[model samples]
Target: MKRPNFIVIMTDQQRWDHLGCYGNPVLRTPNIDAIAAAGQRLDRFYVANPICQPNRACLATGQLSTVNGCRQNGIPLSPGQVTYAEVLRAAGWRTALIGKAHFQNVTDVPAPSRQAAGKGDDLPASVALARREQRDGPDYLNEVRAAWAANPDRTVPLPYYGFEYLRLCIGHGDQVEGHYSRWLRDRCPEAVDLRGPDHALDDPAVRVAQCWQTALPEDCYPTAYVAEEAEAYLRSCRADEPFLLVLSFPDPHHPFTPPGRYWDLYDPAEVELPASFGDAVNRRNDLPDALRQAYRMGDEDPHSYWPFHLFEPELRRIIALNYGAITMVDDAVGRVMRTLSEVGLDDDTVVCFTSDHGDYMGDHGTVLKMGLHYQSVIRVPFLWRDTAQRRQPGVSRVQASAIDFAPTILQRAGLRVPVGMQGEDIFAAPPDRPVLIEDPGIGVFRDPDSRSALISLVHDDWRLSLLEGCMDWGELYDLGADPNETTNLWFDPEVAGRKTELLLRLAERQLALRDLSLCPTARA
Candidate 1:
């Protein structure tokens, strides 16, 4: 028997509801929908963190953020930590990561090198004066002001992860030029132009336009081209030797910029607003204002009231655009799947589809991913297709996490799960164990005073949430009754004993797993 080839397709900042199979009416993700139809779709799939780098690190190492020390986006995975790539490479499986890995560099910069140089010193003061000029107008002057205020010393080196084949963007999409800026400028000097008026650099659409004009066939837009390269690799592989391919797409993340055709794919009027769209729930309870402001969700001041409810129309438009981008990626998935079939490797390959985390997608008055644990951000779509004879193909509604994926992939490849992996072999185990999820107590942006941490134990009929740190709110939901989690039953004295029982179970499991970082505060 030959080892099954693994192809894991991960999209950035994508929500589960963006797929057609997940009951979304406007979005047409035919390829992913087909995968769900042919394979097993786990109904309750979640990520340990709602952010990018931490979740990606968890998926790669099969460990939680605290254990791997990749608790934030900018933090790098430790050099000593063993990754699935290292394990597979040692076992003779060819490994390749094509697209956004979000891996961080670990080099230390010297103090002298950090000091200011060139005319860059005057840039910030000039930009601040310009911002003050535009503060009373339609344009957002602060964006321009901040760009000028940025230090010229911040330089991120490449190949943060141990991938044999890699193509990645260091930070946000617009910042791609900064890392690849010199290379692109050198290659296409006439085509590339970064020197425009002060306002042009701040406009996301303008920056994207600059990138498209200067990019080559391979780098023109690495995300789409990488998919093509991965498909070719899949077509050329042999069945005797195993391989692990990570197809990470950076689309649907930011700038809301897609190819022209994709932008036209969906009608804005046809898109439906979310059920919790534009609701003024307690923003401080879930996420900080600074993080929300970073994604342009709210105002600057922590307590300043922003008209989030008024943005529903534009927010729905953004969601519709994001869905269009997802559909574009799905089309790429279809191309890859068809290539596998054409090369006669379809039945010999194990296909897994998921995301690093999920986008807010206008849920709870937020547009992108930053904070909050609503199903919109933490719950991602997980589907696995087992072509191996020993595996089953039926769908399971059991709760699963991203950490379970690495072990499952190793198990399918007949490789051993490392000793320190925090997740179990979800495929080998029975569907009866409760699924657990955790959120660290701090907000990435704004509202620093409203720190909160949550640990949830989910079973078939009930979900018990133990919250600590900032807010003393605990929630118990009958998932059978409140699938949307609209009602909280933690205050009900009648269910107090049941809450305590579930909390005990949660505590016991946390202790057994040695998840000490999630331990409750003294008050909790």
Candidate 2:
């Protein structure tokens, strides 16, 4: 039997409920919906961290953030970490990455020379800054690439953690950089730089609370660009060779900018806010004073946090734009799926779609995610389709996560699961393991504070969260009763027993999950 070709499609900051198939009443995501209809969509899928880099590192290496040392956004994956791409490549599978690849650090970025100089170099700030500004490499975010594009070595990265070839799109929104920027450079120059993280172009339609439409045509959007690249790869590759291609879309994230026609695809005035929107019950005044001070939630980031007291209308527009971004991604997926079928690679390929994490999407008056562990932020849509076999499509309520991806892909490819991996195989059928979600730090996991950490466990329809070293006022949710997570049962005496049981489980999981992959028998 031939190995199955794998294509994993991922979106940035898209919530589980944003899809038409996932009970999203407003959006039309037929391509993504079709994938679920044809394959198995996990009812309870999640991410180890709600942020980008850490979760991506988790997906790539099949290990938790702590194990890989990329606990938050700014920390880069250690070059020593082994990823599924390397394992598959070693097994004779060709691998490539398109669009966002947030596996590296964005702050205090190292130059190629400095990276080669090894970790302990104590260079002055000026020299290090100069070197990093000149470097590019495989930065997963466009902002990072643009910041370090001067270093010619960035174009020729030192080694990608595991991927053999990567065509990185480092920016989000109108801030498209790297190969994506070049694609738009002369082709659609007018729309390319309409807006960016630092500069906003003079377009009225492109202003929706960090959300906007660009002058770029729908076909030239980054979402579409990614599909084009992936399609080209599929057509160029030999049909007999197995390959791993990850098409990562960097939209539906912050700066809420969906380019071209997608910006107006959904009407903001007609868009309804989440059912739990503005429920003060979502507030975290319950946390310890220290944690509360550290993560002010709605008070931290002004761009993403628009108070109804002054900007209720803005939030609605953002939601519409968020959905618009998702819709565009859906269309892109549909395009690629068609290309796969056109090239006759559909039957031999396995397709999996998911997000790095979920977004708040205006739930409880929040636009994006942070330290909150509500279902809106923790639960993500995970769907898989194996076209090689024909079966009734179904939804599996398995407790799984981004970490499980690498192991599953390896399993699907018939490659040996590496001993160094900590993620579970997707088909192993482990019994009732609680989903563990960790928030490694403040800002750049980018939160409001750097002094706190959050860990959550979801098991048996209950979710429990604790602040590291501070437990007086952590959060507990009876997801069965309050599916919207409108109520936090932390102090409710009626649920004390439930809380105790979950706490014990969380502790046990923590003790068990700490890096323990060393093979003693193989050692002398």
Best by lDDT: 2
Model 2, 20-130: lDDT tens digits are: 889877888999999999998888998998888889989999989888777876667766678999898888888889888877654444422322235786877666543
Off by over 4 Å in 1: 105-162, 171-219, 283-297, 301-310, 388-393, 441-452, 515-524
Candidate 1 lDDT by residue in tens digits, 259-283: 5466557887889876766455535
Q: What is the C-alpha local distance difference test score of each model?
A: 0.63, 0.76
Give the lowest summed-lDDT range of ten residues in model 2.
Answer: 302-311
Query: Which has the greatest TM-score?
Result: 2
The true-versus-predicted C-alpha distance at residue 520 of model 2, in Å, is: 4.5
Give the Cα error of residue 27 in candidate 2, in Å.
Answer: 0.3
